[model samples]
Target: MSEQITKVNSWVLGLTGGIGCGKTAVSNMFEELGITIVDADIIAREVVLPNSKGLKAITAHFGEDILLPDGALNRAELRAKIFTNNNDKEWLNALLHPLIRIKILNDLNNATSPYVVLVAPLLFENNLDKYCDHTLLIDVPTSVQIARTVKRDNTSSEQVKSIIASQMSRADKQQKADDILNNDRSLNLVHIELVDLHKKYLQYALHNKTNSH
Candidate 1:
C-alpha cells in the first residue's frame, strides 16, 4: 500500500491527567471497548529509539551521558535533569515535540479502528488539544496522586510531588475535559464507568455520523 493510502479510520480521543491520576489505566479500559489507543509516551520513546532523528537531536543537545552504552537514550537521567531545569525542559520539548507529533499522526492514520485514544499526560499543556476530537480527564485527589505514583514508580513522595508540580492543576484540567472520570473508587466501579462512557461515546459518534449524512 502507498504510504498515503493506509486505511486507518481512527477518531482521536485525547486523554489527560495530573501526575499519578491513572490516565493510562483509564485509557486501557477504553481500549478494552475496541478503540485504537495511540499513546504519546510510547510514540515519544519510539521516536527516540537508537537511530531515530529525535535521538540524534537529543544527543546533540544533552550530550552522550543521556545515552546508554549501547546508545539508547537514558530516560531516567534525562527526565531528572529536564524536570529540575525549565530551560532544559523547553529545549528538549523544542527538539522532540514536532517529531513526536508526526509519529503520532502516522500511527493514528494507520490504525484500523473507527476511533483512536491519544493518551498524553500533558495533553493540554503541550497544546495537543488540536489533534483530538474530545478530551477525557481522570480525576483524583492530589493526595491519591502522590500515593499512587510513589508506590507505582518506586520513587520518593518528594519526587512524585515535583512531577505533579510540573503539571497543570487538576481543576484546570477538569475544566477543559469533555469527559470526566473519577477513579477515586474501586476497580470494578472504574470499569463500570468505562463501559458506560464507551456506550455514550459510540452514540455520540453515531449521532455525528447520522447528522453529517
Candidate 2:
C-alpha cells in the first residue's frame, strides 16, 4: 500500500542509516537548518502507547504478558518473543508498520519547513524510501557500527552484530541511496557536507513547490 495516498505539498527527504550510524546526528543537523524531521521510531512508540488501538491489538494477540505492570509495552519481553519466532516478528510488523506510516505521512504533510526529513532506520527495508523525493544514507563501516552501538547502548558486540545482520547490507543501502554521507570522519567534516546537502534540498523543495503549482 502507498503510504502517501494524498498529495504531499512538502518535499520529503528520506534519511536512513544502520544502527549507530549517526542518523540522529544527521537529522539534528537538518533541524538546525530549520527543517522538520518526521521520525518513524518516535511514531512507532506513540502508536503503541497505553490504551491505544495498536497496544490493544497487540495485547489481544500476545496477551497481557506483552505489557508491563505500569501498562507500557514490555519491549524486552516482546523483543525476545519476536527474536525466537519468525511468525511473531512478521505479525508484529504487520500490525505496527501501517500505523507508523500513517502518522509519519501526517507529520510530513503538516510540515511548514522547506523540506521534511523522514528519518527511518528501516527506510529501504520497508520500502518507505519509495515515497521520498530523495534518499540519503549515512554510511559507516560495520566495525564502527558495532563499536558505536555497543558503547552507546551498553550492549554486547555480539548483540550489535546480530542486529546489524538483520538489517539490509551496507553495500545494498549504498547502492540504493540517491545521496550518501560517509560519516566515518569527524562531525566537523560531516557538518560541512551536510551544509551543502541542506542547500541542495532547499533547491529541490523549491523546485517541487513550483511544480506543484
lDDT of 1 by residue, 1-213 (tens): 123423334556788888888887888788877788888889888989998988998898888999999988899999899979999999887778778877777888877765678899989998888877778898999999999998998999998888888899888888899999899899799999888878777777676557666
User: Which parts of model 1 have CA positions greater than 4 angstroms off?
Assistant: 1-9, 80-88, 210-213
Candidate 1 achieves a global lDDT of: 0.83
| Candidate 2: residue 153 Cα off by (Å) | 1.0
Candidate no. 2 TM-score: 0.94
Quote the lDDT for 201 in model 1: 74
The candidate scoring highest on lDDT is 2
- Structure candidate 1, residue pairs in collision: 11-115
**What's the lDDT of the predicted structure labeled candidate 2?**
0.93
Structural RMSD, model 1 = 3.8
User: For residues 164-194, what per-residue lDDT tens digits would candidate 2 score against the true structure?
Assistant: 9999999999999999999999999999999
> In candidate 1, where is summed lDDT lowest over 10 consecutive residues?
1-10
